[model samples]
Target: MIDSCRSKADFAALRRGRRFDSELLWMSFAADAGLARPRVAFALSRHAGTAVVRNRVRRRLRALFREHADDLAPGRYLVGTRGAASAVTYRRARAELARLLETAGAFPRIKRTPT
Candidate 1:
């Protein structure tokens, strides 16, 4: 199993000065302090829906991310749902994420500083 580097600080540190829009959600790799592997922090705002709906959105995004973790290079990613994401299937989500990754300059080379 992929070690989950779940930590509140990890997510918090990522949001310090990062900026994003409807197009993508991303964060660089952050050390778990507790675990060596990088973790993910998804951002599904209340604007997305009610708690039940928000949880469902997160759940779906998590499952989709879990399914495609292998393709994503190591990073403490912050995922935000774009306008397209609201209506995408799992397959579409994966493809859209891949496209975003490419657009974000994440591929060809994933830049990393000392963590």
Candidate 2:
């Protein structure tokens, strides 16, 4: 599945719905079993870094979502990077993102495969 997010209407739903925040990101989710499309908005403000740094942060965060989209709930999510995200590596970013999702209770606990 592709990580495609479009339209202001979808995002408006999340913002007006339930919300959660971590040091690394912000999440807005709602329980809609009726099926609303999944969407994401990333916020990398100028205060986060210079142009080059900001873009790099954006790329890394987008990649994390692209790779881990299945872990998220089907709703609008806005991942806003705080000032500290610029200093972290890609792997660290991934960990932070996972932690954020877990804290939000958005990630379902995965079953372990027995050898």
Candidate 3:
């Protein structure tokens, strides 16, 4: 199961980590050797929307993260929404987040055998 980043240190460590951005959101990832599972946190600015809208966006991101947890590296991730994210459809947001995660090397590279 996916875990939530709850420590202040974890959040602070993201400053030293790699980041990937998209029109809908930005993601930061910090590899932690001590972790067996990935931990994630979400940040939504007031400019993104009202509480209800922000919560909806947050929920969508969380669901996407959970759905792809097994494919992600063991690390701490901070996902923040952009203003555009407030109105994005779930499919569009998923596509954007998938691209960001791929860019950030969150998924392990698959080695191919010569056929």
Best by TM-score: 3
| Candidates sorted on lDDT, descending | 3, 2, 1
Error of 1 at 105 (Å): 4.3
lDDT value, residue 102 of candidate 1: 60
lDDT of each: 0.56, 0.69, 0.87
Worst ten-residue run, lDDT, model 2? 29-38
lDDT per residue as tens, model 2, 9-107: 766676677767666666666534455445677777788888898888888888888786665666666777767557858988888788777776665
Which segments of candidate 3 are over 4 A away from where they belong?
A: 109-115
RMSD of 3: 1.9
**Candidate 2, residue 74: how far the Cα is off, in Å:** 1.1
Q: What is the TM-score of each candidate against the true structure?
A: 0.58, 0.76, 0.90
Output the lDDT of residue 39, model 1: 66
Better of 1 and 3 by TM-score: 3
For model 1, the stretches where C-alpha displacement exceeds 4 angstroms are 1-5, 16-36, 82-88, 105-115
* lDDT-best of 1 and 3: 3
